[model samples]
Target: MSSPASPTIPIDGPTMDALMALMRLIAAGVTDDDAINDALGGVLGADSDSPQPAGTSPVSSAALGRSPTGETPSVSPFDAVVPLPADVPDVTDTDDGGSVPTEATNTDGQPMGLSPLEFAVLRQNSHVVTGLLKAGASVDYIGGFSCTALCKCCYSFHKNVDLIRILLAAGANPDATTNNDTHSASCLIISVVKNNVEAVKALLEYGADVSYEWKGSNALAMALDFKKLDIAQLFENFEYRKAQKNRWERYQNQRRRDAEDREAKLDALRSRSAAPTGESPTPQPVDGRSTPTGRDETRSPSHAAGGGTGSPRSVRETAQLTENLGAMDWLVPLSDIEWGQQISAGAHGQVFRVTLKSTGDIVALKRFPCHDARSREGFRREVELLTKFRHENIVMFKGAVIDADVSAMLTELCTESLFDRLERTSAPIPWPVRLRWARDIAKGMTYLHTRTPAVVHRDLKSMNVLLDGSGTVKLCDFGIARLREHTFVMTQHIAGSPSWMAPEVLRGDDFGPASDVYSFGVVLWELLMRQVPWPNKNMAQLVGLVGFAGSTLELPDRAPEGCPPQFIDIIRSCFAKPEDRPSFRSLREQLDSLLVDVD
Candidate 1:
């Protein structure tokens, strides 16, 4: 057992009475000399001396002249105990007047107690106190006044768990009710108040009462009051821990259930195509090689083998075709069409500035390579989408050319993409011009999303937005654009630009309108900063660093002088979560208001 260090209480007359009272209260049956010496030496800061009483070592003699409890010899008549702070109940009412009593209560009313040193040792000497208890100090003894040692340690000082453990091990009743109705077993309350999970765990393990109502407050209420969520979470059961753990476990299980449902849907989609009735249909090969040959000579029933009404005439004609005829006809198609000057090539298709001879108009012809039938059908669907869409800021598709090996689209020609224009300009686009551009883009995106079929330009990068000579913003490149709820639509090898990809998209989940807002945020960032969004960094690294570390894209230190804060706020708002992001209409309204103010 550790020895108590020393005491700091004054050796004044009133203090001696207080220490004598404290000893009489706590040190019952203290007959052993060493035990007495240890307690006295610790409380009085004793040194060794040779002359001492029986059973008391020479150390007891050294302790004789030292002031008891190391208190000051000088007594002040003015210092007296005032009414306790409103939170701390007044435990002293017996012998003194209604004014709170203390050992050194004086004219001004401030409680006098041990010196600072004594107070500190008393707080930290829990180990020594417990050793004294094993040597036989009454666990029920209330030190000084009515407060027990555990209560004194925790309530007088803050969060003294060392003292709490000693008192508790000495069989301190944590659930003990006081005469004034205040639950005085502060060790249990301290665990809850300080959010000490370990102390709480120990208390529960040792059968501390969880249901004990402590002044309409228990461990759970105290944990909640202190807002110690880690401790509060632990109080779900024995105390509260199990409930918090179960709640989290339930949430995890629900997420798993949702994920399983989504996987089942994806798995079903991967297996076969969705028919008109929402049923998956058996697949038939378009190449017709799965059908048997020699139908005419064998005289086999076509309906029996192929499950179709007698289609032998066409099948027979196909079987008769030789490699020579198939080759001769394939080459004739290449010579008829003229290949034009290539304008641009990106991840999707090669675009050419083509002159249509018959129409006598300049048009852009985008040809997509044919890798599979699914890709061919995707290009066809894109053409269909472009044909139906008509907006001032949208590019018009003239027609599509279906060839044996490749698919192509004819559309209006634009000068260059927005990215190229920005690169050409050295200075930031003028504030007014930037605002107008932002408004135009917002209007276009709004129109696209609000359309009846709801076209989502899955890839909304600066490169996909083209500018005409008149500075009109035309959203082009529908190759990666998706018509809503249409799985047949072409999904690019990668869905979006790296810098502009939303968090959800980067996580390999499908994106919606919110994802578009996220891309808009990057675009706004670019416009404001005049720097490449997600500058010079790989997508994975930036995403990981930003998402995991709560990092963000750096904003420009300075904007053009007189730039409105509202516009800057607009840029920030776009980066907000999907639910918090302002709708395009709201954004337009804000810009309109800002523009009016600027004027």
Candidate 2:
């Protein structure tokens, strides 16, 4: 902690910078003037009358309301601020349920000058927040340090959710954030890190993307670091909204295509008959490629559109991919795809069970938008990696399509994901099949981990593990997977769900094949318990507690109801620290030994 600063410090640098530095020192808990003067030494000149720049506050005055001269204000909190506007009526129960009858004082009762809204928000006075709103104090106004008034509320120790809702409802931007030369934070991030559940709820209700990483701190990272699971559970709402948005956009795109197709077809029929035939010609298969580039021939109805002053679609409906998809030999025509039920959707991608119109082969297709640079790279990686990844336990890459709108990769369809199978099945799984699945997963992981540049399946939850018709485990979802060229790679973003996230990964540290082993342990635990690992749905708390706090997922003290002693040992070993954890090959051999009886 800094020694207490002097009331009058020398103008060591630029006046504003010096003032800012002085104020910062005071804010950081420096209080004794002579000690601060002694600390400053020659820098502490006699001049005490430096003008503070507008929109900046003296040290501790913003919240604690201490005077610039280091003397505590003798007046009450309200005495430091201006009165309400004349046009504004008496404060009523309008903003929240009731008015702030008396403004709540700050931690220390010292007073200083700031607007009513600024004073109330900085001190976390709920009644004052509401009353000021009712008294026409604009929540939209910018305050000290160029921060939005709502941001000040977030900085306070007390999170008054009622006032938060009032501010948001009164048109305060939920996404408004504040940043200085050092730290950056939003209302949601602050609320989450503070473990103020109500404030987080209000922010989320107003459309805050808590998972969104702005600067370095995001609500998800904050939740994990702070151990706030209730806040993390709220992240589900954001994901649901994102999925809904993807579905809605698809619906709109399909509707637009349907309308354009009808118009183009009708125009074509008219043009065909306009050739002055004596009677109506018999219906025939008109060549579909009006504007032909063999691969992009049947792009959309826009290709068939005639040159006219008023064109139906001014621009092309589908955007062409900038990066040509790799491996044209395995290419499938977009026109030949009979899109089936969509199985999953995410921010940048979607998955569907598709049937080939040419070969009538059922395949699982994952779609990525053609636009973003990252998505394009991911599309290319999916092709290059999956084609090389030849293993019975891994999903087989069948073909890919470089559609005008989306880049899609097709893989052999499986019966169902392991997560779904576990949830829907009523009967207890036979030991033979269970052992086989355990062995298959271990084998697949071994194949991935032992490669020249090992592929780390960053997301290794049961949901990404598919069970084929023969009940074989096929590890899937390589969207966030990486090729580990070395022993480990550091990742910038949080990739997998918190339920299976390893401690180092959650802490934003270096990840390796061992990260997958940690997730593998969770799967083994799920298999033994027949329950979802950390299904508590409290990500923030679980991440903080388990990820950084050294809380281990305890293997049952004894063997599970059915099982062998080795099974529990396997799960426990997988959960060990990365360096200490067994390799996938070792794990596979162990699993194979268990499955020897079935074979």
Candidate 3:
């Protein structure tokens, strides 16, 4: 009963004649791209040939714009046809076209028929257009401006369903609108008005805005009014999919906002922690419990770390035993945490993924048995270090609980440790991901070494580094880390793990940041090789081999597939003598240079 918004084409002109000839060539089934380009070049008298490579991406309404291919457009989409009648004064009625202007039009207020692709689409040359698209022709090219190629295809004489699909698959805008102010309607409405069943389906499938209305009447309303049973039937699936999509989008937006708010609060706390008058080092006990004294007067640090008689088992029980306490930047209420499954258990402490009852935010709860002065020192040191360091690659501190019954600290939860990820997955990790992890670890270590006191992460192993949800590396476990006071070099009494420890540390030599570099080298080797360091040796054997044997780790005979070969030298540089070893800053620079073109 009705037709689509059909914009006119100039009736007579050399440009129109050439456009007609191109359309006929495509209609005659000319599928060769080079031949078409040569023919088009001859007609336009162009001096050179331009070829664009087609792009591939997932389609969604969020995938916005006319050309969302992500490739650098070799030339403008309007290159095929342009410079339509600019001298003519367009006539407009006072109501519909009052102030809103429109795009280029000919003397009859129609677009010039100059674009070969648009003309080919109008002629329903599906195969010819597909070939041109694969050969790098832009799908939403706005050259001929019969408003868009999609709008023009809606009125193609026959069942041009395949033609519509070809254009959409090549990244055509399904929701494209005509340029005329009065007829500014979406391609969906144009197809709906023409009762083009297949065109409507194709548009909806390609994520056309279903709720879009033309002149206050939506596609569904128009279909029902016209008694198009087939088109009306499609609305059920459309509405359901749209509802689910909207729900997911809302959830995602809320999560993003919550994360922003939580990060803002944490930043405020971090700023407070860094002030000249920072958190009180003294432990405040709840439930009228006495403050922990030295090991001579109370339980030993080892006894607290292990199972102590009449000790609280979980954070929930610990919170239940506590009295009411006010919340602050440094101190949070013990009752706020909802204890979760235990993530890890170490000789020093137990960590759990706990949720905050007040904000519904999940965080890691590290409960150390700091029942005495000796045990509580680890909690104090870790808390102070966490507050001072707040980099992307470092774990973010939330708050701490220093109850006399149980001492626990809170930090951001991560997905898993690097060691666990590498050991559990049978398939090899992607090079880009592993490369990025190496860079992130280096960045965190560099941040520590560059501080005012030049803190050293004595335990810089794969297990100490963590991977977040996005695969970003976050360094943790600073219990054994040392802050160099008067001098950069100091002797560590707390020995690091044998596998990742430097030879000097094992031999009790004067150590500094170079010791950490040696440990980082072993981690780099793990990332590159995906094999355990000194796998054939035991703890005692590893200590002797790496410490007293004067032996160095060797690169694999062949590099791991997809891994950069330059990292082998980086590892070697890390294993060099104290003076010759590269700084963390230097190591980060080397990895950065190698990953420049890798991704």
Per-candidate TM-score against the hidden true structure: 0.46, 0.49, 0.45
Q: What is the lDDT of every predicted structure here? A: 0.53, 0.61, 0.65
Against the correct fold, how does model 2 do in TM-score? 0.49
Decreasing lDDT order of the candidates: 3, 2, 1
lDDT of predicted model 3: 0.65
Ranking by TM-score: 2, 1, 3
| Residue-by-residue lDDT tens digits, candidate 2, 1-599 | 01121122122233334323333332233445553443232122311243446654232233332332235443222212322222222223322333431222222532122444554554454554554455344565442323556765665432466667778887787766664212457777767766888888788788775544555556766675577867766664454334334435545666788789999999997886675546654443232323323444223321212323222231232222322332357877577778799987765478899999789999989888756566676677667778899999999999887645446889988858887776667678776677677778989999998888889988898888998888888988787788862222122234677789787665545568898999999888877777777665464455444554445665778875556678889988988888999988998889888777545
Better of 1 and 2 by lDDT: 2
lDDT for each residue of candidate 1 in 1-599, tens digit (9 for 90 to 100): 01122222333343344335334423243345565455544433321222335654322222221222233322221111111222322323311223232232323443433222122224344444554566444444432323444444444433455666666777766653332135444456666765567666656665666545566656655665688867655554341233233334545666788789989987986675556666655543333233334334323211222234324553332222221122222111222335578988976788988776555667788887645544554565566667777887888767654433335777788868777767656855677766766777788888888888777887887888888778788887766677654221111234567678765554434557777877877776666666667665454443333322223576655556757777778877887766788877777778777767766
Distance (Å) between predicted and true CA of 409, model 2?
A: 1.1
Model 3: pairs clashing at backbone N, Cα or C within 3 Å:
none
Worst 10 residues of 3 by lDDT: 56-65
